[model samples]
Target: MFTRNGVWAIISKDKIKDFFHRFKSFHIIVFFVIFAVGVLPCFILSRGIVANYESRAIEQRIVNIKTQCEIIINQMGMSEYLDEPSSEVINAQLTQLANFYDGRIMVIDKDYNIVKDTFSMNTGKTIVSEEVINCFKGIENSRYDKVNNYIEQAVCIEHSVTKKIIGVMLISVSTDSIVDSIDILMTKAYILQLALSLAIVVVAFYVSRRLSRPFAKISDDIAEMSEGFLNEEISVKSYREMELIVKSINKMINRMKVLDNSRQEFVSNVSHELKTPITSMKVLADSLLMQEEAPVELYKEFMTDIVEEIDRESKIIEDLLSLVKMDKTSQNLNIMPVNLNELLELILKRLQPIAAKRNIELLFESFRPVTAEIDDVKITLVISNLVENAIKYNVDNGWVHVSLNADHKFFYVTVEDSGIGIPKKSQEYIFERFYRVDKSHSREIGGTGLGLAITRNAVLLHRGTIKVSSEENKGTTFTVRIPLSYIAS
Candidate 1:
């Protein structure tokens, strides 16, 4: 269904499109810029040279004709040339000068009559134009008409002894020879321009192509990455800019890998945590149903176990909801002034009962009376969570010391616990959602593993910081520094 002409047309259209696309490319843009910068001045200079030559040639021809006309006019003024009007000596000199430059000379008297015309076309003719009248007024003038390609000069003739104006000598010279020379110069200049333009084109093409090769390599590397070859590192170091681009892309790749791992881990942890309570409930229910008319005491015990499992599930879901809420609450905060000392005291008071269960002591100390702008509810959660974790993870009869201090700009809360310490490796990830230091111990302690993550988020929302430092069996200390006035990021 295709003809050769149609196929050729299609190929030509595609080539045109690709050619324009290349013009839009970075290297092609560079090429055209360099080419223009190189060629434009040469073109301007060529035209300038031609124009200058034409001007100077026309001017020199005018000067020579004017000089010869002045001499003849002076000789005639001393003799009886104007009265005679056709002297052989004057006419001969005028005719010869006119023939030399391929021009014409006219002698006009005071009465505006052409007394002598070299060409003999307008001899004895009366002329009354502005130029001849002005020359009789003793004003000498010259004009070059480029459109007519001729130069005309009006020289006022003066008497030799009296220095009074007698007549005007008008000279006209054809510029055909100057024009021909200019045409030849233009032709040569055009040839030179073409040669230089071709050379510049070659240089532009080579330099632009060579300079863009590294970028082309970078583009190919990124394309390969898009095709799922992410494990390979982009390594174009030919240019510093390319090197920086490669480094940035490689850094992004590494970050993506980290986020990918984090996502997979989060999903696995969620599935396991949600399934755990259901499994325990299923086991308890099955055990009860397997009994043939189980006793009331046994049923009550099984129901209590089931209820505990349900509570555990509810707590996990609640913590997951809080973690999800943290991601969206950076822009929304019910900020207000609250007494930090009172808030810490209230947190310790509420957590005292939990500490009492483990025979752990809760101590609160305030270095100064501190008031700060904060979201009371979120700040309460952050403080209570840290203090509660301190209480929960403590050794029997251990102590939790909460101290509050403040300066002109910020308030600091420090919760130190004498409890099981975190390993250096695990400390780095303690704030990550669903990350636990010791799985068995975390489960026994009934942690949803999202407390510290939520705590970190709350602190960050307030434009504050929380840091933990600990050693094995040496306990842990969490220090929170919050600004006196909340500043929105």
Candidate 2:
């Protein structure tokens, strides 16, 4: 829809709809309003400026005519002569004036009869044309209007000395030259506007696509994720802030994946852990009842087995409670400066008896003394878990090596064993709670599977990093790196 202007303009409905869609409807309306106020006014003002120039040209011509007529009248004093020689003399003066000014001149008697006409007699053309007749009748005063083959026009009055109407002067200037100039200016303006509008549209389209492309990609990624593709990540190439947003989204997806896996593992581990002891108790009870006369020795042995199963179940419950506490951030580490090398010495001394029972050769190797600020109790638990796993998994006379080293920034502790190594596929998930590389072996070795998970959490609390390297039937190495100070310089 358009409002009333001096002149109406046409626009296509599809163009309007497209503009409204590209920009908002409200903005498009405002744009049109501004275009009307700016461009339309300029077009109208240009036309007015052209008209003013024409009017000034016409007015200047009239003034020129009046000045020429005044000079002629001053030279040849006005006198009404009734004789032919006097008339001829006055007519000659009028003829000279007409030739000089490029206009038509006529001599009239007191009764307003044309005695002599200059252009008509000189050029042998009729002076009584419709326009000339109108001028003689005093109806036209050299009216400046458009004429074919003319560039400009003017008309002026030739009055009698007594202030009575004597004759009218008509001067015509060709306007074709000026009209051509104006048409050229109009064409140039149209071309310039077309070029500018095309440039604006191109720039707008480019910027919109550049800004909206990343978001469109992100939208597509989200659609894929919604279809059970949680492994997929949204990738974007943009500025740092845009990258940060994309990073945050991907991190959230990873956390959800971890949580889902944790939940499934938790349920399976809990059911399996509970079922083992319960099934053992049931079997033992059933076997005892099958003997009608149970021996005293057999009864004591069965009771002892039941007590051990109960203890095992209780320990599992306690480990679960500890995991819950760790999950909730309820376990706070009392950190202090502790000599890591000295701490390793204590752990090795305590595990030596268990190593001897398994006939495993235990060794501690330290390149240098390394000190770090850590919680002694938590670190001890981490060491204990690693050593216990080494003892449990090793064959008779297998070797376990514990070592310590330090760099300028971080302290490193490593534990390695010549036991059955973890598979490459399982290394990535070994630290996850209740994840077992070999389910049957894990049961035989009596692992609750929460040990490594808790150890990882403790190391993280100390702002440390842990990594595992292993190959089947070779050896497994666990390395932990911790900063020497809580605040690294």
Candidate 3:
């Protein structure tokens, strides 16, 4: 394609394909246009120049011939035999002139009668026409004609000296010299044109290669990037637009690196989290069966505990699946205003009996109502996990406190417990899936380590934030802050 200023534009492969498929070979048609624009004019100009050059050369040759004939006529008229000459003498002179000039020469008398003929005087040969007879009345006539399909010409001149006409001399000129000159010029033009065309083709090929190189590099780099080669960087020596593309690609590669790290952390944490419940269920089952004389009521309690463990396992599996779904696809959210106080109240109520069995007091303290736009199910999961963890990890006679507060733009919730706190270093890793600050303690307390990670993901889905404040042996508090306006709905 050509721009308004006459610069050629590179055609993309998809565009070329589209042209062939829908627009009937549009790019191919443009190839001819380029040839016409760049090459045809050169050929046309060369032809005109060669034609003018040949014309000048032929004109110079004609002038030279006329000069030679005038010099010869001056010499002939100044001779003593100018008035009358014998047939033998005239024939001999004509023959000598014909041999010297590489042509046929004839002398005509003043009466327009042929006195000496160069060719044989034979019957059934080319005859002198009325035009030749009339030529005696004219000064001169010269032109080229085809005789026997070969180039030949006649040049007739009235021989004169000092304004006195003597006779007419006719010369049969050979056009071989002119034809040879034209042929040489035409051959040179063809050779020059061929060289120029080859140069253009070579330059065009180099330009096409240079233009396509960057795109080829980009394609290879992207293919590697997609295959999880996050460190792959694109390097393209190209124009500004291509550089911009490389910059964008580098940014995407950095993002993929972060995502890959997050994914690995998530997988590691989930595996450790799921292993806890499975180990607990196995140990508890073994312990219950080892009693030779187990009480019927105790066996029933153990069976109920096993059922609860199975339910917890099922919930963990469901949560894992939900996370996978959210990661891989886009889904519509069920958004609504969820009252943080009410939600926490329900979660605490559900966990109270468990806390009571452990001799841990469950407490609630909230003066302000907290409401935010959220997905109710995911929000419930976040609150429920926090409360469950607080109860499970509490000290004997220790208290678990829940609080709520809100502002015009945000709502905040906190869950605090008197339990062994996370270390400063371990707190940073707490929200990573399957991460455990105290793995043995978590297993003993029937804790699946995925609780905090799942809570974080749920809060993130609501465009919210979560933070932990804790010190070893000083207890821990989990705070969740969510925006009031941006809800899943």
| Top candidate by TM-score | 1
Candidate 2 residues 151-228, lDDT tens each?
222222344465544443344444454567667766776676667556555555565566666777777888888897
Model 1 misplacement above 4 A: 1-32, 63-97, 108-113, 126-142, 153-169, 191-257, 277-310, 339-346, 366-372
lDDT (10s digit) by residue, model 3, range 305-420: 88888877887787688666555432556777777778778878888898899898888888787777777878888888888887777678888888888788888888999987
Residue by residue across 282-352, what tens digits does model 1's lDDT show? 99999999999999999999999899889989988998888778778778898999998888888888888
Backbone clashes in model 1, listed as residue pairs: none
Count of backbone clashes, every candidate in sequence: 0, 7, 4
Residue ranges of candidate 3 with Cα displaced over 4 Å: 1-183, 199-315, 318-330, 352-367, 397-401, 487-489
Determine which window of 10 residues in candidate 3 has minimal summed lDDT.
146-155
- CA shift of 198, model 1, Å: 5.2
Estimate the overall C-alpha local distance difference test score of candidate 1: 0.89
**All predictions: root-mean-square deviation over Cα?**
7.4, 12.8, 10.3
Best-to-worst order by lDDT is 1, 2, 3
Model 2, stretches more than 4 Å misplaced?
A: 1-303, 324-333
Which model is ahead, 2 or 3, in terms of lDDT?
A: 2
**What TM-score number comes out for model 3?**
0.56
CA-lDDT, candidates in order: 0.89, 0.71, 0.70
